[model samples]
Target: MADNRFEVPEYFKCPLSLEIMDDPVFLCTGSGHSFERNWLQKALDRNPFQDPITNIRYGDRLTFGPNRSLKAAIEDWKQKTNYHSASAQRPPSPPHRIPEPPRRPFGPFTPSLFPQPQFTPPPVLFAPSFFPPREPVAPPRRPRRHFIPCSPNRLPEHLLSRWEWLR
Candidate 1:
């Protein structure tokens, strides 16, 4: 694995968003095109028989299906990144190396890559628990009864922690 962080596999990217695919779907149009479900649906509504990127016409009959394997891979990637982000105590492992799944010459689509001996659920932190049970919330800035208009407050661009300044 490379020393660089935020590295994502090429196949994991969504054609429409140009970002890592959140929910992959097989448009099954020309070349059996794949995209994020919402993105494809939006594009399909506009042009049912044509691919957005290639402009290749797939004819009138359009079909779409979920890319379960790709979706699972994406979710797994998300979990790993999130876990790495939250666990400051745990030393960062080497960058994740996702095993490549099978793919066509032009179309890169496959099912299982991280084939576990058996299915295993993600960790507890991947659940709704963001902060620890004992971690106290920061004090609210505004009074409950007061309404301040045009509060020129902006949220931190990245995770805000006391440790950020140390780096």
Candidate 2:
């Protein structure tokens, strides 16, 4: 058995980096099985491409890397691909970029993306008649106060004196 090291085949090596491949592997229409991502990544990591922004490895197939020119790479790809009707078609529109709020606002804050108020129009406001007048609440009655008199003649003298002294 040969070395099992994660070595890619020579053909798979990216010209820019001349190393083993990394991410997405693109097959160029001009040359089948032209580019490999792992090789591109290794090449890019070791020594960034001269263009930096874009790196077009194979004929029409472009392996995008940081710093390389996107527009140039795309144009090159377009040329190499021969502008095949179906392949040349514009890519699908990306999903809506809904702006999410950093965090829910405490009160009265609305999201800009969705301008309309979330709350539905207060379900047609019903007249006071909608609800029966709360059973008429009777005015709370005031508690009655009464006074008890302690007559000096009715009390025993010592006891009354003690009571008076205690008071």
Candidate 3:
């Protein structure tokens, strides 16, 4: 036996009409509270039904939903508000990898197309002298430290000598 009772989900129930809707209208709003565009304009110009709140007639706004009035429409839209916001705030998925385009064949009239080189593992070489006996030498000793004393007054004399050389 087919279950025929209209046991719709709580979210499916239109907030405005409190009834099951068919082609529900979703409002893309800002701040998750206010509608972004002129709801009246989008409802009138883009919609097919008249504004329920304003009592204005619009052709494009009328969608194939169950709700009739604008208040009813807004009600249906409100139910999906949380869903729309969560989906919008979620990070976008990474792009899918597209298949590479087919390569054109090289003909006699065209220049010989060279195939891309493949990775080739080099042959490992071996030698009996690889592990040769080592004759180690001792490290050289450090040289004695040498310190030269200088005065601040000598700096100007050094600069003067360089200036005289320039002349």
For 70-145, candidate 1 gives per-residue lDDT tens digits of 8898788868775242345578799989999767454246545555487788767665576568877898898569
Q: Estimate candidate 1's alpha-carbon lDDT, on a 0 to 1 scale.
A: 0.70
Residue pairs with clashing backbones, model 1: none
* Candidate 1 vs candidate 2, TM-score winner: 1
Error in Å for residue 132 of model 1: 95
Worst 10 residues of 3 by lDDT: 28-37
Instruction: Name the lDDT value of residue 139 in candidate 2.
Output: 98
Clashes of each: 0, 13, 15
Tens-digit lDDT track of model 2 for 83-137:
3333237787789898985775555665555566578666667887888878888
- Quote each prediction's TM-score: 0.43, 0.18, 0.21
Pick by TM-score: 2 or 3, better one = 3
List residue ranges in candidate 1 displaced over 4 A. Answer: 1-3, 30-32, 83-167
Per TM-score, the best of the predicted structures is: 1
Model 2 regions lying over 4 Å from their true place: 1-7, 36-167
